[model samples]
Target: MEINRKIRSKKLSTRVDLTAMVSVSFLLIIFFMLVGELSKPKIMDLTLPNSCDISCGPIGCFKANRFYTILLDDNNKIITYFGLLELPIQSPKELQYGKNGIRKELFYINKKVREYSASIGKPNNGVIVIIKPSKKSNYANLVDILDEMKIANIDSYSIVDYYTPEETKLLAMK
Candidate 1:
């Protein structure tokens, strides 16, 4: 039996075809990339002025009715007034931080402006908001006001540091 045994020399190849796996991997990468772009958060576009003027020059040309001022105190209180700094209407009212507060007031003002523009046969002169943060106001309040501006769809707004004498008195009071 040993003399009749025969020897075999065949060997198996170790090569593997990875084309299908590679294609699947690439497809998964593309799918994830598309999902990432779709899941991105929406952001508001804010345009800042090129100059930092304490007071707007040539106040006569400035539309008094379209201007607004918002003051933020250290205690997280907001005071909003409309019209020129030389003479604000009555006094700034206290407002909370949300849709029912500043957002409502801004929409009302904007509506009046739109009505006035229609009467004059002119396009809307968007409301200009001047945000003044007192020395003691926190950063969170500033962010919140900015968010409110976005929610209100305000187009023209500025973060100004200068406070008029009247504003100073207002902030100094309890």
Candidate 2:
């Protein structure tokens, strides 16, 4: 006997609602942004002058009493002179590389500069450092001296290429 059979097929919808997923993603992004904003980085602020300023003129314009020159040579030998480069009045003081070495000297010199500025009724502009790296001086010594400057809180410093005869003589004096 042939029996009639009824077949029923149910259609399922493939479309999905993505509103919840989109909202969760936005929340995660905002959470990360807030966390990033809360954690701030600590850094030292160094104010470098404009390189293209023509009015800067020469280093001679800087205060002579506040000028300090550091000469680096081979064997990690550092010679520091305080005074005007134009005058050979002060002798170069030989110093080692350490806290008790150049750092102490710098502190005393800076104190003197401050006192001088106070006497002159001018602001303490700090010392102007002239770093002259000789051919015998290696890159490490130069970097060490620069680090010392930062530790000393030196505000004004410049690397000069030319070496004066007086400086050469001072270096030769052992």
Q: Which of the numbered candidates is closest to the native, going by highest TM-score?
A: 1
Model 1, residue 166: C-alpha shift (Å)? 3.0
Candidate 2 global TM-score: 0.67
Q: For candidate 1, what is the lDDT?
A: 0.79
- Which residue ranges in model 2 land beyond 4 Å of their true spot? 1-62, 85-89
Worst 10-residue lDDT window, candidate 2: 47-56
lDDT per residue (tens digit) for residues 87-169 in model 1: 76535788888888888998887777777877888664567788999988999999999988888877778898888798888
For lDDT, the strongest prediction is: 1
Tens digits of lDDT, candidate 2, 85-111: 566336778999999998888877777
lDDT score of residue 140 within candidate 1: 97
Number of clashing pairs per prediction, in order:
0, 0
